[model samples]
Target: MEIGTLQWYPGHMVKARKMVLENLKLVDVAVELLDARIPMSSRNPEIDLILANKLRAIVLNKSDLADKSQTEKWRRFFSTEQGYPCIVLESQLGKGVNNLIAAVQELAKDILEKLAAKGRKPRPVRLMMVGIPNVGKSSLINRLAGKGSTRTGDRPGVTKGKQWIRVGKGLEMLDTPGILWPKFEDPEVGFKLAVTGAIKDEIINIEQVTLKLIHILSMKFPEALKNRYKLEVLEEDPSETLKKIGVKRGCLISGGNVDTLKTAVIVLNEFRAGKIGRFTLDELS
Candidate 1:
């Protein structure tokens, strides 16, 4: 299986990092949103390290699109092995949001307690939500606030600025624009993001990404492609499988030839949107 590669970080990402750093002092904790399908790949390691001293909670957004059992495995893995509190959430349906306030309060309990002990009026736990582009940051904020409080679109770089959303009695959230690292050191991480729709398709080759996705699915979840597209699994040439999907889906040319490029887009879109089924591109062994 091949991982997708990404090149180029837009100007907005650079600006977002600075903005987040400038406002870091205002927040008590950080809620990092990650796509459940590719948790490791979707994370910005540099930003995480920079915010290391702050109380952090990982919200595995888009949990509905990922395998439920695997999601639980990841939750346990983060909590037990990594010592980070992790929650699996579905922003679209508003699932697992009620626990967000409680989780944040628990993670920042020490800070809150220390303030209370000093007879200082305990301030609301300030939380900053951060993540890479298109990782459901806005959607999660909207879900947490119980309304469409933030502008959300399918494309990346949609949340341009910062906004504070009050979640509960003593909790507030600062929504930050999505940020990507300066450069993707590991090409696999870039590819996973591209395959999962975190990266803009215009900057990437959809056909190439789709082929790589097919290769990964062929090994990790072979039945996913077979069941979703009803195409025969091929061990030798994966392009043949993509062509078969194109033929089945009627993505064809005027002369009745398979349009592999069109088929690639359909497959990639379906997989990213969960039409293919609940799946995770990466797994912990």
Candidate 2:
């Protein structure tokens, strides 16, 4: 399947764009959350235009699921090259929650300082959290608030409306619905998003996605595939490799034929859950 021909911008994403624009005036800073595994692909291209002139910071969420060294390189690329304050975060575990908080506070300091100079009362830092679907925006908010303050799920578009939640005495955040652009510029970007669970499984061909993943793992992290699936040797063809995995894992029908669909789901779920291995699909270069 050609990923370029696939389009997933639904009506809700259009609403999400309008919602962000409407709420832009209500926030002091914008925190863009990106998947640590595919930082370049998971970023919303429209964000730069929407957040122009606003204090912006990048949070590489789900850092624990990505190669630690690659995540660091991405952080430096965004911070040093792109001029966005970047922080690596494991939102599910709250590993870098404090660093995110500190980064936001530091970015908002100038806004607060100006208010102080005018002898106006200080206000809590208002933050706008934006990202592509399933990039861990809601999870990060929950971690920052230290509770399930916002709705969260493994699938995309879980948070349909905006919600204001107080994280601390001096911090509050506006959680918006995850947004995707009308179209993807690169088909490879779509593939990356599909493999990473940012796109709904029902929207894409699961078998093709699994084969693509197998191909990538075979080339980049062959050990992960071999070790996780107990394969002594990998087949050059991903379909053949998948069948071997299905047979080993006992995904078979009455005729003893491997259920490739079931096997695909298992592999995709395990990959997203970090059971396969820590990997970074996007490279710095």
Candidate 3:
């Protein structure tokens, strides 16, 4: 529970990963969504192997909840350096959704051109939306399709199977269930994923994860943490900061002890809601 070793590869995730690999053959392009707040952590490295030779576009989902400056930098980093077209979008709010469509089309331009050269009619582009859980894949689909096309909740594993949903203007999307790698070798990666709600809260001890989140905030976003919690002094220790926050938010037990569980839940939920502030957990450099 103390950020030791965290492994959460449910049976369904393995099945989902397998489904993605197998279904890759049917898709014309791969659309991988990463949490704008923790872009690197949310990316599954296995995707490169799974999507070999397939044209891919990276969407930094939930961009509204992340630092806009950092999100732009990340977009450029992927587009200019990695050579993968990247779009920063808030799927729920519908910001930059149109840009995502354009990006996808651009990625498949050559294929579309080839089809035209052969005197064949242009076909609807097929894309498999891929990413770890809770990175707004379902939200993106709902936004694009303009309805509750897929069942969506804040929790993971909502979309259990791959679903084909048609969007306007020559686009058909295959919405796949979010899946994590079998093992999270780096505890930090696990911590980041857990803190960002990509990993289910049931799988991790929330108090421990909250402590790590607080530690990160204290280091990377001290001013935002200070202003949100309204603390006069930023404590060197994350536990101290958490305790202060617990006291301020009145998350206390019967004996005046800090109700860590309640405090952790509040911190995590608020962070995810962007109440504290827009933050980019993954660094560009």
In candidate 2, the residue pairs with backbone N, CA or C atoms under 3 Å apart (3 or more residues apart, or in different chains) clash, namely: none
lDDT of 3 by residue, 1-285 (tens): 365445554776678878777767767888888999988888887878777889999999988888989999999998998899899888889998888888888888888889999999988787777778788888887788784343322323424454676777677776554454533667778888888887778878888899888888888888889999899988888888899999999999999999878988999999999999998888786
- Clash pairs, candidate 3, are none
Q: Which ten residues in a row have the lowest lDDT in candidate 3?
A: 149-158
Ranking by TM-score: 2, 3, 1
Residue pairs in steric clash, candidate 1?
4-191
TM-score of predicted structure 3:
0.88
Worst 10 residues of 2 by lDDT: 151-160
lDDT of prediction 3: 0.81
- What digit string (tens of lDDT, one per residue) describes model 1 on residues 1-285? 334344555676667777777667668888888889988888777865668688888889999899888788888988899888898998888888877778998999999899999999977787877788888777877777765333222323424354666665777777554354534667677788788887778878888888888887887788877888886655547788898888889999999889999999999999888987898766876
lDDT of each: 0.78, 0.83, 0.81
Which candidate number has the best TM-score? 2
TM-score of 1: 0.87
- Give each model's clash number: 1, 0, 0
| TM-score of each model, in listed order | 0.87, 0.90, 0.88
Q: Please report how far candidate 2 places residue 96 from its true position, in Å.
A: 0.6
* lDDT tens per residue, model 2, 22-71: 77777888888899999989887777788988899899999999999999
Q: Number of the top candidate by lDDT?
A: 2
Q: Give me the runs in candidate 1 sitting further than 4 Å from their true place.
A: 1-6, 9-13, 147-162, 232-235
